[model samples]
Target: MAILSETPELPKAAVSPQALVGAASPLWAYFGGAAATGLAWWWMTRFTPQNLEAMFETAAVAPLKAVEVAEDAVVEEIAAPLQAAAELVPAVTSGTIEAAETVEPVMGGEAAPLGPVAAELIREEEAVQAAATPVRPRRTPPVPPSSDT
Candidate 1:
């Protein structure tokens, strides 16, 4: 009676792989796995830019590009005035002589060589242009700020 009451053993159930597989649906396992992957992707995309050094590098380059574009525009503006002035000198001097020749026949119809005054003015204009020519050498781009910690 003691053995029957205290030591009776029940037969253990055996589990086979196929029986275990049939018990649980594969679809639920796949859905849970997919959900976990999606959550991970969302988290990484949300925080990836701050964590990556390349984003800061790209930001740093933007100012340098702006500076380069501004420099080009400044140089162009400065050159335009100088070019106009240079053209005016030739046109004014030559156009006057040509007009004189056509309207009132000049002596022997030989155009006078440019006078010393004209030569001096041309020289002065050229000197001014030489001085105005932008002497700035192409500058190397500034180094990006260090992100190294």
Candidate 2:
């Protein structure tokens, strides 16, 4: 295969106007954000006593306290029907069934509790684990093979 000529100039890449983007962003954006943040902080301080100077300013938080009281009333109102329905329905759990079943015999002839049966099963499983004594396929003190010239 023949190589291409070096005189052929490569096409120029498209460029973004980053300076125009930066210039288009107004100074008011930062000042507006700062002003909004300051207002929010002031509002928060009105609700919470930040220092000894703020302890006297409890009147503004009264409206927020009223809102909290209304929220509790609304929650009780919303949950009333759900609470009534929950009381009417049964709450049978899986643990209840498991506890009931655990009293029955796991093995033949004699009945056993869950604790002893689980312990016996675990003890039996250890033998299966011990039979393997798992070995990893790795170079254990690798030796060089003898080579003939």
RMSD of each: 28.7, 19.2
lDDT of 2: 0.80
- Candidate number achieving the greatest lDDT relative to the actual structure: 1
TM-score of predicted structure 1: 0.23
* Tens digits of lDDT, candidate 2, 76-142: 9989899999899977899989888889766677666569889889988998898879876896886
Candidate lDDT scores, in order, read: 0.84, 0.80
Error of 1 at 1 (Å): 74
TM-score result, candidate 2: 0.23
Tens digits of lDDT, candidate 1, 1-149: 77789986877677545665553755678888999999999988887335457878888999999999999999998998998888888545887888877896446867779999999999999999999998988999999999996
What TM-score goes with each of the models?
Answer: 0.23, 0.23
